[model samples]
Target: MTHAELVFVPILGRGHIVSMVEMAKLLVGRDPRLSVTVLIMKLPFDSDFDSYTSSLAASVDTARIRFVHLTCENTDAEISSASFLTNFIEGSKPHVKRAVAELVDSAGSTRRLAGFVLDAFCSTLIDLANEFGVPSYVFFTSSAAFLGLMLHLQSLQDEHHVNIAEFKDSAGELDFPSFTNLLPTKILPSIVLTKESVRSFLEHAKRMRETKGIIVNTFDELEPHAVRSLAGLGAPAVYPVGPILSLDGETKKKADGSCGGDDIMEWLEKQPPSSVVFLCFGSRGSFGEEQVKEMACALERSGHRFLWSLRQPPPQKGQIEVPHDYADPTEVLPEGFLHRTAGLGKVIGWAPQTAILAHPAIGGFVSHCGWNSTLESIWFGMPVATWPLYAEQQFNAFQLVVELGLATEIKMDYRRDFRMESGVMTADVIEGGIRKLMEEAGGERRKKVKEASEKSRKALMEGGSSYLSLGRLIEDILNNMPLT
Candidate 1:
């Protein structure tokens, strides 16, 4: 293979696309002959990914990566159901098919399509890869534990005739396979309980089994059991190449084309090491006014140095997504809250999460337990107080709190009743949760996470498990590549 090329197709979400691109950068950095081509999906409005991807690509002078946008006819309709997770990939199949055909047809005599790397959402395209006589791999931007649970859930639904929706009206312990945690009905992924999600997830589950191979953005040390189960699925291969994140303080740049957090960094430097608690939900997370007020009261009662990245509740009409810049906190939060906590706290529209989590002054994280945030906290050896909002976050939180024992739960049943998903958590609960996470005796969590962090770093170095596994995956794909 002279100039091996891989096609990466990522869905229309910030976390998903960013992880895929960063993985591309890593593959290019490690392999001299490899190159990656990313296919981006265009939306009705200017997307956050548009500026972020273009900016990041410009800084990398290696010429090893190229991005192409796949334009579709019904972008608005596609985005309308973006919460369905795989809807864009479903709606844009025609566009993706056309783009792949063009690329395959137009490549010169010397260049060859090495393989296809698809996001979990792009699983439906595996057949297209077969049509072109190339292998297709599904890249999961989540933890191995969650992946295992989803696979098990599919088996339960298919074989045992388990009705996942029954958990919605009733609450009890779940009989999940390969998952040691005693999962409550309240803590499943938001998708598992929704009627619409049933179809999307089932189709995705089936496609997952049909791929040539799979890769996960997690390490072996983090979830030995789950990763082991995934390998036992007997795929072409299951490669674990992660903590595959930028630990060097590279925040996902804002869509406006700026790093945008010098002031936050300067403030962090002023605080003592491990003194501040950083609170921020993931991109789509937002809270109702009641929850905001409760959080304000909790911060006051806890009397801890804090940095909160707050946003307004989701718009009444549409899906949950991050606003570029939200309005002032005084308007939405309780009166006098900002002023009372002025010297003791820092509140920003959007906190540079990757930078802040890597900071020395950050002792704890008050997170929505998004997998990216969860993995980042793990990489930096930070303890977490989990508050899951939506999607698969509840499941991630369960893993952190119960399975991994790396975090404390703020509210486990917050999303059990979807109608009360944004309901308030009392100031008492919030205060106690923060105190439990930040002021725990003996620092056992910090010690455990630090040890795990060390193991994760070593896994990416020479002769490490993750590094060796990735080498095997590359060799398998190259050896199996069809002759042009």
Candidate 2:
């Protein structure tokens, strides 16, 4: 009997892990001989998982997938600190090397590791694949446009115009032809400025450039310029297979609580198209109490119907209270605002985001600009209001707002130098942006968003760009390896 091909290891982060998991699902669905083992920090369950997470967990189990947790504690500090980001970049190769070594040691002679697929950030795993005599494929989750930006950044640093720990605004445009406008040095990934950051990026990019093949979560038609540029890199053959989630059916299991049953789909079904705004900050982004209250006020005042997913606030000594000015408006809001905008909004501690976005009632999204969120929104034919919080989000926002022509930038206090500490955007700015999106009839911003939504739908249909790419990816995988 032929053995199943197992894909082990993932870059630690919600967005990275989610995209990689979708790729594994694609491989398994294409052939009976394939199977996948996902090594994550934690599985999608506890003794009692929430409805959304539980549904995700059940979907994995139904697919006959294997789960392995490295049990590494992904601390908040580890995710946020520039020092930690640096360490992760520097240590990723060694970390993957050790993890794969452990996997090989634990597997008996009967179980073969087969081929390995890893994230672009996991550069060291390529060497491990070489040692194990398995083909290695690098998976880049961001759009091709961002990859082009990274390549350009490498060139700029090579010329010594920019250095680590020192990045002045480059008034001139970026030299890359694929770029639509002058690419400022400010929007580049943090790991490209300093010598240490540059070295880390170079190490990983070299591995990717030298690897045998690569897969990008993008469709060819959507980014032909950037895609052609990457294809010219000459080392790895780039395959664009994307809109993966749209190809996969929803596998939500029903949730039963003592009060009643809650169906996320039903909630979405009850809303109107382009009327319900869905808000979700990526998993790692957090805000102070002040920012949270301001966000709530903006949503309430925008006069738009909405669904917001918020994290549980950190514990304070007494009950946390909104400022009196906000509280006096409406109780459903801070203290009294719900009565004013009754039935216009619902702010849950958390919502099933994917389910909500895929709903017919959801016309637009307020997103943190995580790549996964960007892809999901496009797949659902929904427009976005880009509010990037951190990391690659700024780059993602640029792609959405400037390159893709699908979203508007939520003007925040982020400086030209990209510092976040000294600024806090006020409720007025937030309210103004939302008001334009929801109410300003015939506004240019609204018209652009609507057009993008229609285009995205056409892109995912039969023979459409995303659909054809998915077929090509499956064909490549299935034909390359025979079922036993």
Candidate 3:
């Protein structure tokens, strides 16, 4: 059978790339006649992704899914600027248009061209898909709630021309449709606060709604209301094909950094079951040196066994894209801090997050509340103490703490640049939040998350909501093709 070929494009962000890659893997596995080509836009600062993709291809059936690369100028220095993100993605259009056109023109291409499945930020490619007479689908790397917020914000700006600035001081709640109750205007995305961000994000939202379908990275069981809101809004077709996650699968599991070889895992193995607290931010997650000191203080005072994968502070959004250099905890942490917490916890440079979350030794999570991490924690039935740093993480934190009631909050007010300012969470409050999730209300939170975990599992199982949605998507792609 000739495979139906779908091209997927992702913004250079790690989370966006990861989920899309997983989606590609799932598509090929579900239908042998479906093939995916992921076009990777390589930034100058990003390492040669060719070799990396080569390795990834070796791990999978390369005939089914292969990665293509397009080298684009890395606007590293500008990524921190509000307009830089807009500029970066928009800049990829010409190169992407050419690359995609070449793929469409290839005479020896064995697969039937189906359509495009692109990252939310890469909506610029939709025009190219249209020009090529191929269907265009969009994949949202975040939650359905975030999707609703995007639409609401765009309508608020474009349709109403209501000043987004007014929300800054308004004690009134955000009128975003996905939320069950009023959302404090203050906790709205930082992007909504500025004109450039508003214009760019609204543009992305508008383009997203124009796609043939919108694929969200959340299971129906996890975000029923938000998912319903997305579908009911009369936008492009909505498919909830996630918690696109795996429990025992190798595709989702990182190696033994969670097993006994690492000191952190060794310590975890020795600790009593469900006693150790796991703290990790996203791959780009970092805290200031001063904030790191405070975290040390909090961990020490919490008197909880712990595993911390600490990385250096990230550059500002518009600044250089220098990567994190993991330092010895003893060197970067407070003097004598490692010695003090020696027996009580373990601090490592990097962690295999999936492994740690799966370990029975883990009791609670202190996290930055990125959706991937949030989903992983929920998938494992572990409760969390949220500490949001940037992007829509505050909203994710809200979804966990307020909407789902499965997480406690350390501090939601900490903005993207809080490291330059100061620690919003004092050691006391940090310790308190950790304890509340691990001790005071740990049982209740665990039960809620476990139920969510089961539902999320079933949603992806055969004949379940997520599985059916994915099947429908594949069928739609296949049916849309011209009969050979």
**What does candidate 3's lDDT look like per residue over 377-399, in tens digits?**
88888888898877788889988
Number of backbone collisions per candidate: 0, 9, 6
TM accuracy, model 2: 0.77
lDDT for predicted candidate 3 compared with the true structure: 0.78
State how far residue 378 of model 1 sits from its true place (Å).
0.8
**Candidate 2 wrong stretches, greater than 4 Å:** 1-4, 42-57, 61-64, 71-79, 83-113, 158-165, 168-173, 190-198, 233-235, 246-273, 312-333, 412-419, 440-484
Residue range 1-484, candidate 2, lDDT tens digits:
3435566566655567667777777667655656667655432212222343334445664353665545333333333234444354444445555666676676564345666777787767677778766667778888777776665555555555556336533434455645666566566555554444566665566667766567788777667788888755433677777755533454433244221114445566777766887777755444556666788888887778887765542233222111111222233336655555557876554445676776778767888777777878776666777777655676777777777677766752232222234256678988876765556445665566566556566665777776676666555544544222
Worst 10 residues of 1 by lDDT: 75-84
Q: List the residue pairs that clash in candidate 2.
A: 164-193, 164-194, 274-363, 330-336, 330-337, 331-335, 331-336, 331-337, 332-338
> Could you tell me every candidate's TM-score relative to the true structure?
0.93, 0.77, 0.92
Look at candidate 3 and tell me the lDDT of residue 172: 75
Q: Where is the poorest 10-residue window by lDDT in model 3?
A: 246-255
Top candidate on TM-score is 1
lDDT of each: 0.78, 0.61, 0.78
State the displacement of the C-alpha of residue 430, model 3, in Å, after optimal TM-score superposition: 0.7
